[model samples]
Target: MRRDNVSADTELEYNLRFFTQFIINPARTGAILPSSDKLCEFMTDLAGLGDVSTVIELGSGTGVITEKIMRKKAGSTTFFALEINPAFVDATKRKCPDAVVYQSSAENVMKHLEMHGESGCDRVISSLPWSTFNGETQQLILDSIYDVLKPGGVFLTYAYVLGVVAPASWRFKKKLYAKFDKVETSKIVWSNIPPAFIYICEKASR
Candidate 1:
């Protein structure tokens, strides 16, 4: 759905179409459909990133938001992007050359961290379509993210309107509540065609 009169770049426009056709439709990639620039900026602000040393983005399609993050990068922040789509991954690497791009799934982020001897990430920004995943896979991904997060690190995810994207049987809300110390949903971005909400979660203290 077209959201704004502001046109996306050629790369971003192509990525949006690719995500809609291959990821959101097939449900294989588990990536959310492309979000409007306004929505992406809103999510970034809600992440409350300050002095973030390492930032990881899951499902970095076409690097639309990845590019924005790189442009806004703080002095010490290093951005890492993990994507399951090979074409999109290659495009992201080329588009956001400053980011460390990984052609892999978010479920494997823990192993990636371990292999790289990385302890924890400061923030995680995700565009994975959690509604397409089963309960177990969703929990697994969330657990993996938690395992590699610094104390009080935040995770940001987007979902279509609450009732529509998140169903009761999906148990996403319940799992999130159980997994994180705090979870909050943002106001709907009505400016977007289909509208969406941002889910921000913070890891609890042990």
Candidate 2:
């Protein structure tokens, strides 16, 4: 029961922080509430993150998914949680001190990894707000992702059900199809505030 209480407290804290951040900058934070544990579970299961050696988490707000990933580690692995929000970065760092919490744009992921003597990631889980970025910005970020992900690596992110027909979301999906040979989607996670689904894109062999 102690563990359950702690989880509830963490969830509450995450929700408060996420709402404040979204109020400060909606485009940066995306949702008003932190991703629901239900969504995190679905994402972790679809990514099979426990099996990967190096994982990169883009836009890891409040470490919701980061917590899920760390809790299910099946092997030794490195994790980097990147976020542009200083508050979210600090909060996530406090919650997940083991991860390299980077307060930088995901576009800089390659440079940051190189600085740490790392080359590529086996899997990347993004919580970024793709529906807010322009096509050029989206391309730049996706290119960076491709550069850092090892061949056969997977890139996963979620889109709110309402975002499915948004112009930016539509374009982002098209970009994923162009870059990845295999793009798969998961069933909607109705438990989340706005309802969301996961996209699992596999990098093709060169």
Candidate 3:
């Protein structure tokens, strides 16, 4: 098969896998399809991965965003991913063979960081479904993210346009503003499925 045809077929396979996971566990597998390439590219670009020494990806579903991170990060970058679902973990590993994918929850990011002999990471790009998380779950994960980031670190995550109005999403937004020193939202990427926008946040440089 042609390279483009092969790529299209692989993406279709990933989409089916994502949708199946969502069907199996809607609460954990929040998105029905893998993130669009445009959304992933926009997020990684805004993250400024060129100089970062350490990076972590949270909730790397099927490795769509993870692939972008692998390609964009500097050669010296130390990167790993946290994913709770075993199937998704396997998928991520398959997609990014060199990726260190731990079958762990986002709340345990600190432990993983310690294993790599790092105090904190410079950038955190999350694909977690904040809109599907309950208040407590959201706060717990956010707290983990906040604590694992070094001062002046950047955090990036995106939300679907429709999900932005959800009560859970609103609460997530508020938490980002409250936790970070600066919070910025990007223009919607209409090419993405359901359309989405990114939230760029930075920890204070003390």
Best by lDDT: 3
What is the per-residue lDDT of model 1 for residues 76-145, given as tens digits with 9 covering 90 to 100? Answer: 7866788887877876776677678898989888777666567888789998877778888888988988
Deviating ranges (above 4 Å) for candidate 2: 1-10
Pairs that clash in candidate 1: none
- The C-alpha lDDT values of all candidates are 0.75, 0.86, 0.90
Whose TM-score is greatest here?
3
* lDDT of each residue in 1-206, candidate 3, tens digit only: 11222377787787789899999999898888888878888999999998889999999988988888898898889999999999999989878888899999999999999999999999999989898888899899999999999999999998999888888989999988988899999999998887999999999989
Clashes of each: 0, 0, 0
* Candidate 3 residue-pair clash tally: 0
Estimate, for each residue in 45-125, the C-alpha lDDT of model 2 and write its tens digit: 888876788888899888888877877655578777789999999888777777778899999999887876789888889
Model 3 steric clash pairs: none
Evaluate model 1: give its TM-score. 0.84
**Candidate 1: lDDT over CA atoms?**
0.75
